[model samples]
Target: MSASDSSPELSSEIALLRQPGLIGCLAGRNLSAFSSQVQAVAVGWQIYALTHSAAALGFAGLAQFLPMLLLTLPAGHVADQFNRRRIVITCQVIEASAACLMAIASWQHWIGAWALYVLVALFGACRAFEMPAQQTFLPAIVPVSLFPRAAALSSSLFQVACIAGPSLGGVLYGFGADTCYALCAIGFAISALATSSIRLRFPARQRQPITLESVMGGIAFLRRQRPMFGAISLDLFAVLLGGATALLPLYAEDILHAGPVALGFLRAGPAMGAVLMAGIMTRWPIRHNAGRTMFFSVAVFGVATIVFGLSHSILVSILALMVLGAADVVSVMVRGALVQLGTPDEMRGRVSAVNMLFIGSSNQLGEFESGMMAAWMGAVPAVVIGGVGTLIVTVLWMRLFPGLRDLDRLDDIKPAD
Candidate 1:
């Protein structure tokens, strides 16, 4: 068969690389990802330095996610109804501008924990709008046949950025916190500029009148899909419980006695593992007992989290976190496929919004939860307990939702009616 006629096994990378605007789109995403990682590492260290309080650090994390919860429905609707490229560019400008203000604040030595949190909250709001808009914009520009490749290329680039961003961010942060913030601002602006340059005859999807009913369509659809709900919920609680990322600052300060540079490597650990695993998965896709694979991956993630919490050696901790990241990436791949393949084109925006809502909140909310738990039980014990809780949740989810556990193939799981 011709390359284009090949089934899903066609080379997605080649197909996407041949496309025009895709390269620009991906470049923009890469730049954004880099800046985000830089901002994250710098802000985390700064918060710890300023407040010396785990709860305050958690609140910083909370500020980023709160917008995702509040604006998910409307954000998705806007992406679907409006010019997604314009929406995305506008949001990028907002984020870039916020980063600029943050940089100024740092340079002026005026940003305390509260000021930093407010800036981060603004950054989060931009992400709330940008994600859904950018996501939907891809399919509009690329041919439908090349979409699978587009997805693969996008995933690979994002993962690469995840690995590179922190390492670069950490190094830049060594110059100064202000330096890090400045880079974030510059990076976001560049990303916005690149995205704006992508000229395509892309058409936005059909829009509906803004109504509470129209906005809530995605949630209502997700409600009836047992496997989707089960998978997403399981991921939500597992991640929320297993997360030790927010406590990294504590670990660096108290346990490992590492500096910000070491913290950058530590932050990059999971992404490194994920990149290694993802490269292999792309070559040999998951085809057997997919549901079982997800459960196993999450279970592995829990165990790795425990190992990370207990380790005193920086190398061991980084290794453990790498394993945790690798496992989580597997879960990410499986769950993403389940969600995207099952949703129709028209509802894709809303469905994506719903997915983003769950995923984004779990991450930042998990950070907050980690902070509270660490404040109460101590970082080591808090992480250990959370890891254990993840294992327990895994077992309970498998039992409570047999349909999810028995999902042997992605092909068998249909879209919501």
Candidate 2:
């Protein structure tokens, strides 16, 4: 399409970005994505340096994710009760400090597997709190009417950073891994400042004082909601099984014969796809059969993963990964909007935290599983089988949660008062 042909959609999206609060939120997201990529490279290199084991690299990933499983509930409760902007800035400061600690260790040549592991564990713990606050605050920035478009735009910007950050990290590593670590620390500082700038108009709390029972009630609420449960679980298992990210270093060196630059591109492929899909979603909202679309998108994700696993050619592998990324983003957008529309305003924070836990846990645990499975079956076979597993799980999930597959439109649903 010509530039003029795309002008209307681009114009609409640009208008959304012009909203001061949304811009601030996007700034925060951009910095976070950059920091995440730098951390990925730093951890990948450190593990590869210490143990030279793909499994160990996967364990590094586990260190980051393990906290989400343990702290996600409390994080949700805190987000519901507190100032989300303050919460995000606080976490960013701590996360920045942690990155600096790792940089110092790398500079002194004192870094080891255990030290990196410890730092990542700490990082994960802080992130458990940060994510819920970040997500819960988005709807406050943009009006409820703009959420579908705004969410797509925000997710797209994050993916843009995902593409840029790793590619830059790969370039920076030529100087030294410590350089990348230091840069990531700076990224966190920027994230803190950006988050501090956002002006949130949160709805006043209607519930009584925060309590353990109230938080647990959120979990109980989820248990009774079948469509929400299915959507969350589907992404969790599909991503867990289909994840090949933790193994990118191996693919770069042993399989594709690419250097750090190529590894960066490989890592960024999915984000590139996600950005593309996000752009598409902004103009054309998915209105009907939302559940079925999610299933098909994820199933396509599995197919793309299978293609990526079997391909050794750099171009082919990148294409496969890009396809996978696009498919996953579609599912992500649909499911996220579904959760937002389906839950009550009072319950948004707690429910969002629950949804995020599964999503966040899946990303981390998927890495662990990928690393362990790759160690046993070797990378190619491991990835291929994981893709197959994702497909099977999707089929079973569809059968088990027909409600999700039957969802028609976000406009038709109403949150309980």
Candidate 3:
């Protein structure tokens, strides 16, 4: 049945899933994320096994972050000026090639920690272009009225991949690193093909002259949109301070006395929670007090981080991580809806690029920070301290961004002028 012909009782999610383009986008996105997660597990295990240093993991994150920092802005402009779908396809192909190279290096017994870092940097470069372009896919494919539900459902599926990828990678790694890398290559290739199949509803874009001002347009836009700025920055600091996912390897092996499989489960824990929460949000989205809900969620994330940091039991650690993940998805959904619906279609790429930068900083840089702190003190102390910092940021941000704090509903956000 046609979407408009469907019964009024039909769920928004069911209608969204019926869209062929969104299906393709979700498939491609899930495959890409799954492959990346698998790569992460293998890289983390292999690097630590080779160097046995916490600092080495931090350096790994740094390797990825640097490329993103350098390329993301220009990449954003490219997304706005070029075919976003083509950009996504091309990036996936490049990533696939890099994964193949890594696999070959591993199989040849010539792969070193440095080689892995370089390949990871290559992956980072591709993602710099891929993300901004990819972010625009939903709004282009679906009506604005259906966007919030679409976003939640998309995140839910992505989290499912995140959960599966690490577990599969951990298992595959036991066979060999080459095997994991080979699978990652295949995943990226399929992702490229899947993305190529998408029919974008809005394919036209206005090309702007390259100037310093245009390049910095996203940053300027965010500055004026206090709610968007606050939500994005709040996430940046909260994740940067509270993240302990980077330390999972240490926790699984040293603290929990578990093996690679257990490590996989540990990695999947948060995704499990995230997917669950995303499902909940999809069915019953936050209708009121979105700003306050976001703040509360972040605070819960901080508390969960603290609990995970102090936990020695595997079950407890996983539970804490799940809570952390669940809390995080709430903030993610709220922020995603706020940013996407509030920004003009023309500026979506640039703004999403800025958003990607914040996310990359929080994740990659946070990993670096966790590693350094773990090296200086201990993993537990570093994680605990970071959690406390997250709490402080949460409180501070509530006071600082009252505009965001007072926000009542996602629908209340209007496109920036």
Candidate 4:
């Protein structure tokens, strides 16, 4: 379509993207996400190589996820009480430091499992703080008129980073672990520098007191919003049970015999599918029966995971992963819209903190769970079982949360009274 024929909304979104501040925010997010993906791939592969235990790989996930589990609420409050830019900058510096440590360990051939776990654990803590701070800071950089579009862009970039980072890291890892670490460290540094340059348009939010109620406010609110809670919780269980990402290393080295290079493509496959799905979704947005679509998508994800787990052929496994990724994006977008539109402004910070905790744990803890299960049942069996679990969860959750399943449109549901 010609520029003149474009819709006003499209024109507005394009214009908003042009703003230097928005560009910087988006770019920073992209770099930080990409860097994290690289770190995860390198670290997971290294740990597996050193220990050759599925449980050890699970432990790596536990080390990172534990901090998010422990500090997420406190971190949310800190973001409200402090300068988000400074908080973000500090987190980025810590992340860079962790990467530096990994580089040193690899170079000296002292890459013990415990040391790698400790560094990754530190990276997780930094991530805990950085996630809330960065989310808060996004709106402060753009005009209110463009904030929604910017938010959408930020979300998309995060997924893109997930798709890109591991692939790039896997490729770089073929050169050397040191190379992966060095490049990740540099990416973190550049992201921090870019973030430092964005201006915060708002003042620090009023601090919530350190009382029991204040800390528990988000949970209380979410409990009352059944449809929203249901959607979020559904995503939590579906992905948590069905996740096979933690098995990629095992597949690469043992099952598929793809090595690090093949692992990179395998890691990137889901993301690639997700990106493709996203492009299609963008052009043909879901306008009706959104909730049913989400349920269908999760079922697809489960089926795709099963295919990936069963496939002995590398190409089929990758294709299956891509389908899984695409299905996940649909579920995420549907659930995210429910959370975003249904949340009241007053509780957004706290509620979002809770949401982040759920989503992050679902991923990280799911990794740990997958690793543990693989160790017990064997990797292929673990994955297939998890996919079956996901399917079961879908049916159970649909029955339990009728509001979520029956809800048709984003605007139809009201926030709790």
Report the error of model 4 at residue 237, Å.
Answer: 0.9
What lDDT would candidate 3 get against the real structure? 0.91
Candidate RMSDs in Å, in order, are 2.8, 2.9, 1.9, 2.5
| Model 2 per-residue lDDT tens digits across residues 294-376 | 99999999999999999989999999989999999888887787677777766777888888888877888889999999999
Instruction: Write the candidate numbers in order of decreasing lDDT.
Output: 3, 2, 1, 4
TM-score computed on alpha carbons, candidate 3? 0.97
Q: Per-residue lDDT tens digits of candidate 1, residues 226-334?
A: 7777888888988899998888878887899988888888888988888877777765566678888899999999999999999999999999988998898888877
Predicted structure with the largest lDDT when compared to the true one: 3
Per-candidate TM equals 0.92, 0.94, 0.97, 0.92
Give the Å shift of residue 310 in candidate 1: 0.7
Q: How far is candidate 2 from the true structure (C-alpha RMSD, Å)?
A: 2.9
The lowest-lDDT stretch of 10 consecutive residues in candidate 2 is 408-417
Clashing pairs in 2: none
lDDT tens readout by residue for model 4, 1-417? 899999977786677677767766777778998898898899889988889999998899889999988888777666666677788889998888889878987988878899988888898888888886676554455554454445455656766887888888998998889899998999999999988888865453676677667766778988988878887888888878899888899998899987987888898898888877776665455667888888999999999989999999999999999999889988877776666556654555566678888888888899999999999999999999999999998999889888888878653544454
Q: How close to the true structure is residue 399 of candidate 1, measured as C-alpha lDDT?
A: 93
Task: For candidate 1, give the lDDT.
Answer: 0.82
CA deviation > 4 Å runs, candidate 4: 1-4, 15-20, 137-152, 203-205, 411-417
In order, what lDDT does every prediction score? Answer: 0.82, 0.85, 0.91, 0.81
| Model 2 spans with C-alpha error above 4 angstroms | 1-15, 18-20, 206-212
